[model samples]
Target: MESWLYILCICLILGAAIGFMAGLLGIGGGLIAVPALLHILPQVGVSAEKIPHVAIATSLAAIILTSLSSARAHHKRANIPWPLFKSMLPGFVLGALCSGYISEMIAAKSLQQIFAVFVILMAAQMAFPFKAQSNRDMPSAAHLFIAATVIAVIAALMGIGGGVLLVPFLTWCGLQMRFAVGFSAATGLLIALFGSIGYTLAGWDAAGLPDWTLGYIYLPALVGIVSTSMLMAPIGAKAATTLPTAKLKKIFALFLTLVGLKLVFA
Candidate 1:
């Protein structure tokens, strides 16, 4: 009982940080949540073979709330571009819906390794920001669909909200930074919603899951994370408008690099 309480406390604290970062950076909180849960879930009795699955699924579940809160805050600021969001919604839904089935086929170790590589690459992208030589208009509908689908598939596999990829893609397509971030936040909600559902359905009959699980989603972690993340997201959204985030991004990039390397070698 005492240990459970301790774990819940840690989850709450982690959720607060994840929420804040999600709102501040428009990242859906999965990047942090996946790594944190990987450490936390094993302490609660999740089996080694299922650890990555639970961590990723639970992170996506948590992101459903975190991203919604962040999206609402960004919406209030009028940052989201509605037409683009609408245009990409179908593809996001389709790709995320398929991700769980795809993940179920992969070995847990392979999934972890894949996530580690993704994290390292994302860290590099964040550490050295990309700049497009010339701003261009949105691509054709088919192009948008392909891009959104691919991004959603990757994001779902990694338990991310897709902002890490989406924001950069949007900016490269001539959207302003603020708008791109906001748009990414909105799209993250869709990804998380469908992605979590897919995971839940896929793992419904799986063995060795810990108690209080909804398929692969761990209830305690999800509840604890959402509880604090929802509250902190608005605060983070407020901070984003005032903070100088370039330095912060670099610091976060370094943190991600370390986490990725640790996962790779562990």
Candidate 2:
């Protein structure tokens, strides 16, 4: 088979697996794809050094579609917190827009290394769940706004869809685990939409990038991953509704730790 065909098949499989994990964990599939693409993308003609940026940008673009599908599926079950969504959207948009410019100035590997550390911390958070000790009420609008801004910045910098920060922050703010996961998934859609556009626009001046590469966006990987993830995300979301996410989240965190370590070394 042609190398391109092999790349497509791998992307499809990775998309499905990542989508399932995203649905189960309330994260954008980018957490998985970013590291995988750091390796896979270089084999398909992208520069080794540029692979991290491409992987992150492509993963973010793919998450826009995956999060939309996952959020819509979960929304039907009355899981989303619409008020929180309203409070966070503005900050999310602003954070996402700023991330692109930030990416241009900072080294891509630096961002990846930082993300590796963040993911390690998040893994520990998921496993131990420190928020379990907090005696807090539902977050206020101001708290949510502040948290949303911070999450948006991190999400944009890491190229995640926002749930990585949103879920934990919501939990710390006193939301139940299930509700936090569901609501964060919904918020991630908006974050990814704005962030993806911003990153693409901001990276337009990057040198030696491929054709059809708008900013840092890799069109081929984006299309392949989104196509499969959109089809599979609903299935994963449905499973989440029926299964135990806490246990799955712990397992997922372990997987994240492994991937995060690889990103650091890559």
Task: Tell me how candidate 2 scores on lDDT.
Answer: 0.76
Off by over 4 Å in 1: 2-6, 23-28, 234-245
Candidate 1, residues 1-266, lDDT tens digits: the string is 75556677888999899878866875557789999988888888888888998999999988787677668989999999999866788899999998998998999888998999898898898889776534788898889999999999999989988988888788888889889989998999999999999999988998988678898898888888989988887798899999987788889989999999999888
For model 2 the local lDDT of residue 231 reads 73
Listing every candidate in turn, what is its Cα RMSD in Å to the true structure after a full C-alpha superposition?
Answer: 2.4, 3.1
Top-lDDT candidate index: 1
- TM of each candidate vs. truth: 0.89, 0.83
Taking the tens digit of each residue's C-alpha lDDT, what string does model 2 give over 227-260? 7776776678789988999898888889889978
Query: Which candidate has the top score in TM-score?
Result: 1
Q: Which segments of candidate 2 are over 4 A away from where they belong?
A: 1-6, 23-27, 130-143, 176-179, 234-252
For model 2 the TM-score comes to: 0.83
